[model samples]
Target: MNASRLTDHTGYWMRMVSNAVSQEFARKVAGQDVTVAEWSFMRALYDLEPVPPSVLAEKMGMTKGAISKLAERLLAKGLVVRTENKDDKRAHSLSLTNEGRDKIPVLAALADENDAEFFDTLTREEHETLNRILKILAERRGLDATPVD
Candidate 1:
């Protein structure tokens, strides 16, 4: 019987790099009083406003409960507003407040900085190749969840 070492797997290397990148970005975003999960949630709302939480959950590939928890946090932070759906009194739609809209650019800048800091060492072709490969794998595996963790 033969067993392969962990280092023999490409997945090991990918995970190592991914974990480092995510951890660093987590630390950077923490300074803005938001977790990476919250950042993902807010980013989703940056474009599609006045959407129901169920729609958000589907877009983010997260559970409705998770969206609710994140919504509560953003609501408390004055970053989002929940309004009743006029057509359906039992339903509510969530939208980013002015403060939330203002903070998106700032948070996006942080994301840009984080990516540059992590992947800037690669050449342009290498960067593109890496992204292409990741996208292919994601599509093949049907992994659509935003990397909130």
Candidate 2:
């Protein structure tokens, strides 16, 4: 194949793999009544005290508006609490509620299962190589290395 054609072919395969992974994880998580994105946000809040939405945005590689929206949904679900920042009168901070905190391990388990289900075909070495490549891509793309909050 020509170089351009090869690039196009690889891109298509990349999207196919990505979509499959994402969809499968979403399906696995449906039982928990949480979307992948919501779970990501909750996982980010795990182990941390109240944090500003801006910090979440930076850590999650999302916009403050998007974080706020996610927080709103989490709040409605009683999974997170948003409160005024003690130090910053105008800014708000968010943290997981007791219920939300308790759900992190469950979601993490689901995530682990999701990975195992999809990537189990790969040998340990292959999985490690894939992880290394993906990490490189994330850095190249300027993506956040921090876990999604």
- Best candidate, lDDT: 1
Give the runs in model 2 whose Cα sits over 4 Å from its true position. Answer: 1-8, 86-89, 145-149
Q: What is the TM-score of each candidate against the true structure?
A: 0.96, 0.86
Off by over 4 Å in 1: none
State the lDDT of candidate 1 residue by residue for 27-109, as single tens digits: 99899998889889999998899899999999999999999999999999999999998898999999999998888998899
Q: Count residue pairs with overlapping backbones in model 2.
A: 2
Top candidate, metric TM-score: 1
Q: What lDDT score belongs to each candidate, Candidate 1 first? A: 0.93, 0.84
